[model samples]
Target: MKDLLIRSATEADFNAMWDIFHTHVAEGETYAFEPGISREEGYDYWFAPRASTFVAVQTLAPHDRRGRERVLGMCKLQPNQVGRGAHVANASYMVSPYAQGVGIGHMLGEHSIGEARRLGYLAMQFNYVVSTNEVAIHLWKRLGFAIVGTLPKAYRHRRLGYVDAYVMYRLLDDPARWPLPEPAPEEDD
Candidate 1:
């Protein structure tokens, strides 16, 4: 495990954040964005004015005086719908390929839940989770999200052809009663 720092993203972090976003979009296996999505489009989607975005960084070392760090992951939380349905939050997450499987995604998931609560959201919903993305599906389920609905052949995966997508939901306003797994210990590499 490595030392992970999760913080609200600043304007200065857009370049690195866009790199991760573009990488995932280009992969075309999970996210639904166009493979050749432009930086401006990526910025508009991930850094929406009303959305709260965050970044996860891995610090160089405890004793490093320069405070050097590497961006490993990022996420955005915002209203799933406007006006009437604003109580439910929507979110998207991306972990850099270099940091995949290192628990950075899990950290971002947990941090986003807390942030959503702090922002007064009653629940959180993921609109288009690619069904083939088993890792993310399992992670969201473990975090208390349920597959509320599925759209058959909703995603045109670059390699896998058409695939189903899931709409996952979780009531964050009352986690105490939710059947969520015990939170994992923070990673410390």
Candidate 2:
């Protein structure tokens, strides 16, 4: 995964972003967005005028005609709500199927958290994460998000019929709200 860089996404990256986003949506396992989402719809959702969209690019350069690096994944960070709830950030991520399981998601999660804090969000909340998505559940927990709540039979999973959904949350700026876990004898890092 060397030379993989995370940066602000531009309109030039939309096609690659759409490819990854479409693949996930069409799978109907994780995100709740409808299948066969149109490009215009995808653009409006993922690249809304004010959304903070980002991409992970492999910089070794099998460049597109525009001479941009290949996009391996994408994510968007934005206010979880408007007005009263705007202090909480919300984000969604999509990694190319070819790049899954190689720590790209983790990289994106870490960067998103930092970016959220930098953008002055007091906390981050994932409103609806399908309970069946174990890889994402594990990564979000490791990244310091807590399952703050769960809605029973919340998602109509494409293959699994009905499944629960979780509301994962983490405080970005309030140290008083952060839990103080005891140190482990052995740490992954």
Candidate 3:
């Protein structure tokens, strides 16, 4: 992980990125994209005009393909809406299954937040986070996002039938001011 490099992605990096993207979507567990999304559709969705794409690469890999680094994870930042809603940011991330639990997801998340703030976003929002994806929910919460809304039975989980999805939000300008949860009551023993 010491050799990891995160930077804005170029078209040359798409080949490696596609692998991670396809695998995660194919699993149908975390993201909402169709499992069989074609490469072209993926390209448009990922690199839309308003989106800024970033990738984490294993810089020390010797088998670089066509001068492209091996992408371990990817994130794209964009406006949550258009015109009147453009001040809010939206982002999505994916990490290689082989690289999970090594802090790749955390790094991508933090980077995206900084990038979003740098771009002048008032806040960031995740529109549809699968409730069953506990790891993602925990990570988002740890990163200062709060579950602002829950859409019951919004996501049709592959194995869990119909599951809920969460809408998480984080205010970038002064995260420290965000409200905290009330602590549970303590009982005298």
Candidate 4:
């Protein structure tokens, strides 16, 4: 297997990023975004308006692979909002279908948390996570994120009607002082 790397994105990465993003969004199972959103719009969403975006690439030795390395995954991070909410960070992630099951999403998620801490964010918040995305939900939960809130029947899922949406949060207090918060207890009806 080749070594994976995460780095800040540049203009050269937009096309590959679009391909990766479109592949996932077209499935309509995870992200709430429209399938037919234009490239220009996606560009603005990922790179232009966001604080930063990153691409994950697999590196090869001089004669290790058939061709040059290529991007396999990407992540976009930005402030949840301006003013009072500036201390919180938000991000979106996408991994190429070819790269799934290889832990690319996990790697990207971990890297984003580190980057968010380095950028001085008090906490990382995911505003609208579709509960049907069990892989992501499980991963985030294991990574110490709490499902702070659940909007019951908030998502209009294609197969499952009125699925819940979640607000997942992880507080990255300080690298030296990892303040692990206790998990919120599950409630029973």
| Model number with the top lDDT | 2
- The per-residue C-alpha lDDT of model 3 at residue 110 equals 97
lDDT of 1 by residue, 1-189 (tens): 567899888877888898888888888999988887888888888789999999998887768988877788999999999986887899999999998998889989999999998898889999999999999999999999999999999999999999999999999866565345568799999
Q: How high is the CA lDDT of each candidate model? A: 0.90, 0.91, 0.89, 0.85
Q: Residue 15 deviation, candidate 2, in Å? A: 0.7
RMSD of every prediction: 10.7, 9.9, 10.3, 8.5
Over 1-189, each residue of candidate 2 has an lDDT whose tens digit, in order, gives 976999999899998998999999999999888896789999999888658999999876545455448899988999999987788899999999999999999999999999998988889999999999999999999999999999999899999989999999998877776445558688687
Give the TM-scores of the predictions, in the order they appear.
Answer: 0.89, 0.88, 0.87, 0.85
lDDT of candidate 3 over 1-189, digit per residue (tens): 767889999898888888889998988888888898999988887799999999999866556655445789999999999986787999999999989999999999999999998998879999999999999999999999999999999997777888999999998987565345468799899
- The C-alpha local distance difference test score for the whole of candidate 2 amounts to 0.91
- Model 3 whole-model lDDT (C-alpha atoms): 0.89
Q: What is candidate 3's CA lDDT for residue 52?
A: 97
* Residue 137 shift from truth in candidate 2, angstroms: 0.3
Better of 1 and 2 by TM-score: 1
- After aligning candidate 2 to the native by TM-score, how far in Å is the CA of 25 from where it should be? 0.6
Query: Considering lDDT, which of the candidate structures 3 and 4 is the better prediction for this target?
Result: 3
By lDDT, highest first, what's the ranking? 2, 1, 3, 4
Candidate 4, residue 104: the lDDT equals: 88
lDDT (tens digit, per residue) of candidate 4 on 138-160: 98898789999998988878677
